[model samples]
Target: MFIKLLLQVVYITVPILIYYALIRNNASLKRYHSILLGIICGISILLCMSFPISFETGYIMDLRTVPWMISFLYGNISTGIILTIIMLGYRIFLGGIGMFVVFIAYSITLLMILFYFKKYSQFSFQHKMKSVLTLTFINSLLIVSSIHFIFGFSESHYLLFYTVFTFMQLLLTWLTVYMIETFRENDRLQLEMQNSEKLYIVGQMAASVAHEIRNPMTVVSGFMQLLYQSDEIPLKHKEHVKIMTVELERAQAIINDYLTLAKPQADKMEKIDVKEQTSLISQTLSSYALMNGVDLHYHIKSDENFYTFGNPEKMQQVLVNMIKNAIEATLNKKAVTISLSKDNEYIYIDITDQGVGLSEDEIKKIGTPFYSTKEKGTGLGLSVSFSIIRAMNGQIMTTSDMGKGTTFTIKLPQY
Candidate 1:
């Protein structure tokens, strides 16, 4: 009987190991994995039930209830109900003197479990163990009582069968409950760490693009702005001026953000004033925004002392990319705003734009190279900005809606 119990226990552990290894984390098969678990548990239960050891001339027993109880303990109501039906039919198919008793016992237990499926599912592990203990006792009592009346089993035989069955069921049920919870928690943590890795990669790519991109953008924008501002420029060419000046400034912003992500910082790092920096960047780009039918607003809610430890050049780079993205995102809206504030450990930069917004999927992949919503976008701008901010020991977070707009918050640790 002890050896039989050990073999029955394998039915529980083997299926669980197979499930966690092959089905649990496989996205394509995950949707139906629970239903698949129910089927495996049913097979394990049936295998044990059919091969029970004979306890007496009129009494027999097995650890089949352990898997059945585990199914309900795991609280899969629909699957449990389906399996209960399968068990009921199988018991009737193997009809005999003691079979009626097993049928009565299982039916009573299963009906109560089905009725309280949700309540049982919400139970703490300890509560579930206690409830299953009580239910298992009742089921054993019903089966033994029926055995005594119908097949004339002696008291000693009844005691021996009841005690062993209940002990095995309770022990296996508790172990099953504990293991499943651990698997779920592990899966959640793994997902979070994967997201953190993507941002880290962005920071790496920035190192490669440094000096190669930034120098050319600065020179081009400086020349274009100088030309765009000339009084001799023809009236018919003003629209082209507005487009060229705004776009050049926008390009510089994208490259700066990209570099921060690469974790390479050669620019002078010091405690720089946030208000002074925004004023300089905005002054340079205001005409570019005007040409694109948008207004640039720099809202400095923090005082002059609101400073962060970062390269001044890189700081302006992220701001430019943010403002440029805002201008493009502005559909019917006319204003793009960059706000600044600070605390003891971090400086917060909020760039809010009124333009075409991103969908839920696009939001998740915001910093990926070559993934963009715009027709001609290379998708490296925001991704590079993310790298630059990360390189400076800062973080970038975004929030958006379909028709509303997007707001990006860049947080840098206070120097």
Candidate 2:
């Protein structure tokens, strides 16, 4: 009896597990395939039907309970209901004397599970384990009573049958849930590790290039400045000289961003007045905003005190890059707002822009080096900003709708 029960478990588990793995990558398919999966489950039950083992009690024992409960436990409500209906129809069509009794048992189990569906879905593994044990205990009692009354199991076999089947169900259900959860956790960790590897590679390359590029840039910048000052130079040529000087300065700035990312000076950390720093940044960007025909405004939620430990310069650098990005994003609709607020644990700086907002893919790659949304952007702005924020133990949260706008919130731990 035990071997038969174990064999049935293996047969049902194979298809169920394979189906779960195939649908794991596509969440939409998992949502849409529930009914079809249930139908497949109903069809799969033919294996048990063809090789049914009847106990001396005139009752047939099969592994229908595995899929019946699994559908409710892991699948959506529609799936569980459909599975119940299909299984009930199959049982009735098979035309056994215990068909009515099996239908009643299945109905009671489904109704009870449906009642706690939402609550059960929210339970942690430990809590769900306790609930599963309780439910299995209740089902064991029902099974014993049904066999004794409807199918008329002999007294000697009733206890043995109830004990064995209940134990098997409990063991198999726990194993299934554990395996699925483990797979989910492993998938999440693997993705996170891949992202970490990308960041490490980017940082290594940035460090290598920064020092090599900075020296030549300084030499070019110095010569360009000297050329600009020469009275012997033609005025038109000096205009070209000025443009070269400006482009050189921009290149120097980008290189500095890279160097700062590669070698963050940790010893410079100190408590910064977040509100004051935000105000200073806003004031500095005011001219830039006006020149671009964008209304940039800064608001302090209160004169509320908030302090965080970081290199104040780097923190301000992060703010500058983010605010500039916001300003640039305000392409035609020229309104940008920067705000500061404080909670018990963190100081919050929010920059919101009425611009062509980011798409989902763009948002994911916002801080990736060499990836940018702007036509002429080098994309180091946000990438360097991401590094600076991480060095300061802070987070940048952004939300955007494609045409509406974008909001960036910088969260830093309060000292």
Candidate 3:
């Protein structure tokens, strides 16, 4: 029993070893460490399967209860299946094939059923109760009935093994529940830490944007005041006035973008139809895309409304940032396309640019506040948009290749 339990524990230890290396501090070493650990675990498992198991004639006490409990405590169905198969293979080779084979087959079936139930329902009270009761009853009936009908074993011994197995199964279930809960708490805390760090980065970007836009805006404002004060200016120099007016507007637009980044008003969230919002933003930005020598396009997959609860203005801001980025990224290409689709209760908008896409290093630094490849870029645009989308329970994913192009996919929950 001790040897069998040890083998089961060893089988279950593989994922933990891989997980430890996968989460190493140096990401460059993570893949190498994980691969090495996995190989070691695989070899160990294979060696364990080659060991011989011999049963004493007519009445060796059944240690079936031990493996049953161990499998449940581990909670990883794959580990349980592997341990059962390996142990059974060894027993079969030693000529303990008859009832041992049946036992191994039953363990695999139980593992599969438990896994299916858990996947469909998770760890709710009802799920746990159902799993426990089903495991207990099915295992008890199989042991008792099989010993009587097939193996011709005694009732007293069968009852003893049945009681022991039940106890082990119960213990295993409790351990699994506790481990799952502990892991979930750790994951929740880790996610919180990551979010806090992202928020800090966003705050820094906001400060940088304010500093960058303030001076240019002030100069533009002063020039506008000078033009207003000059009543004696000649009408022949009206082109100069037009240039000044356009420049001032551009400065104001920059300032506005900064202000929008600094203050993301979440209170304005409403039931926003994604299709309508994207359509409107596409129309509004069409002229800008054309001026920048890029054709802007929108393709909606569904004619029906794709609705989500968010601030339409905020969503529009996100779309504009993406479209503008696409336009700026395009070099020889003449067009950018925004594709919208819905699946699995998510509304997805993918913006693609046909320019020189981001390099591997650039892609890694993306959404990190103030990181930019553009010469004059403030770099707050995507970072601010990322925060806004996340606050709204959405995500922005990017894929880019150096010589090809870039695609930014925005996924938001649909109502």
Candidate 4:
């Protein structure tokens, strides 16, 4: 009788210990809540072991299952370990050598499987589901086989208990996964809503500027044409008319640039050779660089071609802004280098200038409208460039030292 009492105490204590251990690494839950879960499990296991109610047929009642039920609900390694240890202790105290050996083996296996599932299978929903199913199947087999073979218990009595335990555990496991997926969906929805709001604000600002400039642009173009046609106009006046035409064209370009920024959208993407695209931009800008005393240097990391799906025109705009900035910054410098390269899945375009580099604070403010340091800078160039890159699902990053050179890096997804 004393031995049986000691055996029951060991069985009840093991499950509680396992529950405590599982929660040791989990700091997200409140301390009180974790403690409460362990205490409840311990009490439930203890009650199941002590209650002395045998069936009318004289078949032994099994309260030994309470701890396993707790283990299934928790599904954590620490809880499983405690349950196994407590069960093992109880069986030894009661001098049930066969039952003790079988329980120890099953407990260790279950704990190991649980640990592995948590590590590798936690990253994806599908993996988590498969792992849970595998573990449930193994656990069910352990309980049923132990009762049938090791304890020599009647199959008819314990079979119903095992089936009901499996069903309850399956339901609990499904609920846990479902709750986590719901949280992930909510986070994704919030991000989409914020992006939509930003786009709406940008569109409103762009429309106001376009409305203000269209009439003035048309009047200046018409007046310049009249002055050019009048033969009586002096040479100097003709020269003035020519200047008006050029300035009017520049204003129209500025209006178009602003419109692009306000109504930015994803480009029509196609897979193209990234290296070739970079080469073309460098070649096109080469003449402008020479006239301005800016030497262009192009570098490719390897001889192989790189490919990505993107809008070629939008990519050209991004490259042009970066190169123009480099040229303007390096006014009297000896040379500037435009390096192009690729790794496994990304294409990098770096424009380095030997001229005076900007301070950290200046670099941070570059993407904002009207933030240019140039005497004639509109500040909208870099801002428009930023919008274009983002539309293409790419990023632009910059690094600069106050007196040293500055490097601009543009990264695009490669096919």
In model 4, the Cα lDDT at residue 102 comes to 48
> Model 2, 3-43: lDDT tens per residue?
67667777677777677676676755654555656755665
lDDT of 3 by residue, 39-105 (tens): 4444444444443222233333232433443343333446555655655565566565354545754
Each candidate: what lDDT? 0.71, 0.75, 0.64, 0.65
| Segments of candidate 4 deviating more than 4 angstroms | 1-202, 209-212
- Give per-residue lDDT, candidate 4, residue 192: 40
Q: What TM-score, over all chains together, does every model reach?
A: 0.46, 0.57, 0.56, 0.52
How would you encode candidate 1's per-residue C-alpha lDDT over 99-121 as one tens digit per residue?
67777788888887777654453
Off by over 4 Å in 1: 56-58, 73-75, 119-121, 192-415
Judge candidate 4 at residue 125 and give its lDDT.
54
- Better candidate by TM-score, 2 or 3: 2
Better model by TM-score, 1 or 4? 4
State the displacement of the C-alpha of residue 99, model 1, in Å, after optimal TM-score superposition.
3.0
Reference-based lDDT, residue 243, model 2: 99
Worst 10 residues of 2 by lDDT: 116-125
Best by lDDT: 2
Q: Give candidate 3 regions above 4 Å deviation.
A: 1-16, 19-23, 30-251, 291-297
For model 3, what is the error of residue 52's alpha carbon versus the real structure, in angstroms, after optimal superposition? Answer: 13
Q: How large an RMSD does model 4 have? A: 14.7
Q: How far is candidate 1 from the true structure (C-alpha RMSD, Å)?
A: 12.6
